[model samples]
Target: MARLSDQILTAIFSLQRHLLEGINETAATELAIFEQFGETEITIPALEQLQNARQRLTDPCSRL
Candidate 1:
């Protein structure tokens, strides 16, 4: 099975946490622009969406 490397996942999770901490609209817009081109940019349905999914997903992984 193929999956993202651990380093990649860590970076993604870290980005999620960072984004959730608070981002003004202007910064969010800039991030959205970067995501459009960034190789693993946090593509947003919005950071809240990503954060919700992150909370759900990471919980199970913690048991392993």
Candidate 2:
């Protein structure tokens, strides 16, 4: 089995956190835009991914 390098692991974790935070913020912003303009179908289903990313980031060695 191949081992995960520390740099790769750290980069992956960092990306996860960044993506999670970005998605959560994006979702919130999308909702705001929808509400402000009375538009529909702007849901990106990002919140769930965001949560998953967060979980992955918080849980060490769970990538395997």
Candidate 3:
């Protein structure tokens, strides 16, 4: 049972990382689109936040 629980937790973490990667990609694409439309003021902060979130998601210590 403990082994199963560990497997479940590992799977959840894998899924979380996958989702975060998708979100990061989307954020990057959106930032580029925003730049093309001359919306730096709005997108800059959003991009920064996304970057911070991505960093936190990828950080090993965050899993604890």
Candidate 3 lDDT over residue span 12-36, tens digit each? 8788778677667866776776768
Residue 61 local lDDT, model 1: 39
User: CA lDDT of each candidate?
Assistant: 0.56, 0.60, 0.68
Number of clashes in every candidate structure?
Answer: 0, 0, 0
Local error of candidate 1 at 49, Å? 21
Q: How close is candidate 3 to the true structure, as a TM-score?
A: 0.49
Model 2: what TM-score? 0.50
Q: Which stretches of candidate 2 lie over 4 Å from their true place?
A: 40-64
Better of 1 and 3 by lDDT: 3
**lDDT, model 1, position 27:** 53
Clashing residue pairs in candidate 1 are none
How high is each candidate's TM-score? Answer: 0.33, 0.50, 0.49
Badly placed stretches (over 4 Å) of model 3 are 1-4, 37-64
How well is each residue in 1-64 modelled by candidate 2, as lDDT tens digits?
Answer: 9999999989988877776666566556656655675543443344445456555544553442
Clashing pairs in 2: none
lDDT (C-alpha) at residue 1 in model 2: 100
User: Which is the better candidate, 1 or 3, if ranked by TM-score?
Assistant: 3
